[model samples]
Target: MDFQHLSYFIEVVRHASFSKAAQILHITQPTLSKIIKNLEDELEVILFNRTTRYIQLTDDGEIFLKFAHLTLSMADDLQVSLNDGKLLKKGKLSLGLPPVIGVSFFPHIIAKFRDLYPGIHLHLIEEGGKIVEQLLRDAKIDLGVVVLPVDERHFDFIPLVERQLSLIVNSNHTLAKQEIVHLSELRNESFILFKEGFSLNDRVREACIREGFEPVISYESSQWDLISEMVGVGLGIALLPETVLGRIHTESVKVIPKTVPQISWDLAVIWSKHHYLSHPARGWIQFIREWVWLQRSMI
Candidate 1:
């Protein structure tokens, strides 16, 4: 008998009622009863004992039930093997990334991923680095990009990128002409920083505190350009990665070398240390590692 008829027989036996099995399988009771009848006819034996109040398996039916269960289980394993293809031909992955990092890095990689595994659907969730880390811990996303020096104990990661940060100030600001600026030099300067959920914000504040003073907070925003614009008008100075500088109007703000323990924005792709990655997620991790290796070798 075909798998369809066998599965119907198994479901009918599982519930011990044609009506219940049909409801569970979304088929009609008559259709289920007919299939069971055809299976018994093919086997030349009675499969069910029917009464007004109860439906019970016959002696022969009980014996066939064991084999039926095994067959169905094997079918299930085969289905899983087919669907969860080793090449990531069919699956879904939910990945989290900081907005700036995602905007900078994923465009090419994502397009290439689509070309390689057309059946796999990729869902990207954008948020701040701290929020992305929280999402990873909470299992909201399968994988994420987080800033470095995070709680290493809870994550397994691969280093992504490291970019130098510069001191950004109004072109007319006093330190604008300085070749190299110190973190402590900005101790008294008003700061325009990122909002609370950004790792960069924590890093900036902590650096200031380490330099022996709290940053004088003048403004906070989620967007670096907003921080840059505020700095442009002499609102305050801010620290930003060199990559972001290209996107802003260069003339609006002056960038000076930052050297009091040079600030570098280091990032990594991370996943929960204890979480079991699905085939799709594992495939993504492999792809990222290989891509990173190739990029490095080229350099």
Candidate 2:
């Protein structure tokens, strides 16, 4: 029998009344009864036992119910698989990126992805790395760019950038002339850092603690450019990813190429291990992997 007839039968059995099932299914009671009759005729058996008070399933009806449920389940699975393939042609993706990371990268990658998958709409959420991690956990975004050293147990990540942190000091600062500055030498200096939600905040703090002293904080900001601007004014020194140095146009600050205990500024694209990744999200990860590979080959 057809799926609709089987569904009506299940609803009748659920309510134990043809009138109640018809009301729930938004059809007439007579129509539901006729459909059930046709289903039983097709199976060549009495499917239901009817009485004035209530209705009950016959022996054949109980056996047919099991097969009906299995058939509907398989049909649903087939529909879902077909829909997933259609999604590859047109779908949406939500991606979270820290402000610093977005500025240093992703613009070109995003443009290229749009070129390749013109039908897929992209929604970008800009937040600090810590906030991005929270968004992923909450399932607010499909994928995220976060700083490395994340909880590997909770996330599945692909390493995007592996680099070291560079020190930036004002031109007039004593350490400006030095090509390489030891992390310990900056212990006495006022440090400008990224705000609380940024992963760099913790990374810098942990690195400083490893070097045997805590940094004396002078200011904190969410924007890397603002932090570097404060450094340019001789307010305090800041450590940032070396890749971002090219974008810091403030000639007042000089970047030190080397640090004694080199703190890493690695980045990774992450998604929650527990969350269900949509087709577009999975496609994005694959696209990025290929893009990164192409970039490395060009380099």
Q: Tell me the spans in candidate 2 whose CA falls farther than 4 Å from its real position.
A: 1-87
lDDT string for model 1 (1-299, tens) is: 88888888888878878899999999999988888888989999998889656688889988988888888899999888777667687888998877666656667888988888898889999788889888888988899887797788999898877777788999999998997988988878999988888888888888888889999999988788888899998899999877677777768699886658787788888999977788888888898898889989999
lDDT value, residue 49 of candidate 1 = 89
Task: Provide C-alpha RMSD values for all models, in order.
Answer: 9.2, 9.4
Pairs with backbone N, CA or C atoms under 3 Å apart (clashes), candidate 2: none
Model 2: how far is 212 from its true place, Å? 0.7
> How far does residue 182 in candidate 1 sit from its true spot (Å)?
0.7
Clashes of 2: 0
Q: What is the C-alpha lDDT of each candidate?
A: 0.85, 0.90
- Work out the TM-score per prediction: 0.74, 0.74
